[model samples]
Target: MNLRRLKYFVKIVDIGSLTQAAEVLHIAQPALSQQVATLEGELDQQLLIRTKRGVTPTEAGKILYAHARAILRQCEQAQLAVVNAGQALNGQVSIGLAPGTAASSLTMPLLQTVREQLPEVLVYLHENSGSSLNDKVMHGQLDMAVLYDRAPTAGITSTMLLKEELYLIGAGDSPGHNVDLADVAQMNLFLPRDYSAVRKRVDEAFSLRRLSARIIGEIESISTLTAAVASGMGVTVLPESAARVLVSSTNAWMSRITSPTLNLPLSLNVSSRLPLSPSAQAVKNILLSLLSKPTIEDRELMLVG
Candidate 1:
C-alpha cells in the first residue's frame, strides 16, 4: 500500500537485481529488501524469485509492477500540473462576449469553469457588440473576445469557433416553418446597427438577391430586440443560437433562411501585436476546452456547433 515500497519493488523488478536497484536508488540493499518484504506481506503475494543470477519477478510481482508504474505516472502528472498552474494562473483575465450571439451563452459556463479549474484566476466579462469587442481586443483592453469576424483588422487575430446560419425570427405561438430569402426581405425587419457584423452580412445577402430588406427599426439591445419580436413588432434576422434563446424564452418562432443561406463566423479574437499574459492564456485554454466539449443543455438549445 505504501507508494515508496511500491516504487522500490518496481525498480528491483526492472533491474532484475535488488543490490543494483538499491545502489541506483541510493538506498541500502537490506533496507530495499525489507521494503519489498513488507509490500509482499501486505499483499500476501510471493513477489520476487531470488536466484544465483540476481532476481526476477513472480507472476504477482509482474502485475503489481504494471499497476505501480501507472499509479506513479499519474502522481507525477498531478504534481507537474499543480506546479505549472501555481506558477502562472494567478491574475485577472478580461474576456469579452458579443451579445445576441452564441458566445454570449458561454459567459456563465466560462465563469463556472474558470472558477472550478483555475481558482486563483479572476475573471472580468464584458458584453458588447462584435465590432466593439474586436476593438477592445485590438487595443489590449480585453485579453480575448468571442465575436463575429469583421473585415481584417490590423492588430487582431481571429480563430473561428463556429459558423452559424442566420434565421428569421418572428412572434408566433408555434414554431415557424423555413422561409425563403425573398420572403424574409419582404418582412419588416429589426436588426442591429450598420456597424455590426450581422447587419453587414444581412445587407450583402439582400443586395446579392436583388431584393431590398425593409428596415423598420435598428435595435442593438438583444433584450429590446427580443421584446420587439415577441410583441409582434416585426421579424428580425439572427443566428441560430440567439434565435433559439429568444424563441424559447418568449412567444416567438424561428424559421431557417433558405435560398442562399446566410452564415455568420463566430470567432475568438485576440491581439496580434501582443502576446497574452499567462493568466489570460490559461483562461483562453479553459474557454476553448468548454466549447469543444459542449453540454447537453447547450446541444439542446443549439447554442454552439
Candidate 2:
C-alpha cells in the first residue's frame, strides 16, 4: 500500500472535503483527488462517496481509515526513533503536566536541565489537571506527563516519582493553627476545579469524614488559587511542593494536613505500547534520576526545617 496515498485518503476523510484537505496538504485539489482515487483503485473498493454535503467514508473506508491512522502513527514513531538514535538528546519533546506539579520544585529544574544539556531539543509544556494530562499522554499527544498516581490504565506505564504530603495553607494571620478536618470544613475553601486529582482526593476525604466543606471558589490555576489563599480569602489544600512556593513568596503558612495525612503519589506516565524516542528516553531518565536524588527530598525537608 502506498503510504502517501493512504495519508491523503485519511486527510480527505478527516476534513470531509477534498478541497479542504488539498488546502491543508498544499496540493491541488485535482491531484489530491487523484491520489485518493488511486488508493481506492489499488484497494479494489470505493473508499469515499462524494455527496453535495461533503465526502463521506464508505464502510470499507472506515476500516481502512482506522488501519491507515495506526500505520501512519507507527511510521512517524519509527522515523522519530531513528532520528533520535542518531541524534541523542536532540529533538522536540512535548510534555504535559498537572497544574500544581509544574511549580518550581518539580518542572522548572527539569526544564533547566533540558535547556542546559539538551540545548538542541525543543521542549513544549502543556498544563492541565492530572486526569487530563493522563488522557493526553495515553492518546500519544504527549511524550510523557507528570500526573497523580491514581489507578493505572492499560496502555500507559506509570512510575512513581515521589510521595508528597498535602498541606493546609492559609494567610499568615488567618485564625488557624494545628487545624483539624472539622476546622477546615468550617472555613471557606478555595480549591482547584473538578477533574483535578487533588480536588478528587479532597472531596473523598471530606466524604469519608461526613464533613460539608464550603468551597467558596473553584479556580482552575493553582497560581490563582494560591494567590487567593495568600490574600486571606480562604484556605486551600495543596501539595507541599506548591504550598512551599507560596509560603516562601507570600505571607502564608502551611501545616501538614492530619486526621489523615494526605499522601499524594506523583507519577511519570508514558505510553506503554509505543517505544520512546531516544531523546524522550533521555529526558525520562533525567527525570527519574532527579526523582531519585536525595537532594530533592532534602530541599523539601529544609523548607520545613
Count of residue pairs whose backbone atoms collide, per candidate: 0, 0
Cα lDDT for residue 250, candidate 2: 84
The top-ranked prediction according to TM-score is 2
Error of 2 at 235 (Å): 1.3
Q: TM-scores, in order shown?
A: 0.68, 0.79
What lDDT does each candidate get? 0.83, 0.79
Global fold similarity of model 1 (TM-score): 0.68
Candidate 1 displacement at residue 290 in angstroms: 0.9
User: Which residue pairs overlap in candidate 2's backbone?
Assistant: none
User: Candidate 1 overall Cα lDDT vs. reference?
Assistant: 0.83
> lDDT winner among the candidates?
1
| lDDT by residue for model 1 (82-156), tens | 767747466678899888878777788988988888898899999888778876676456789998885677668
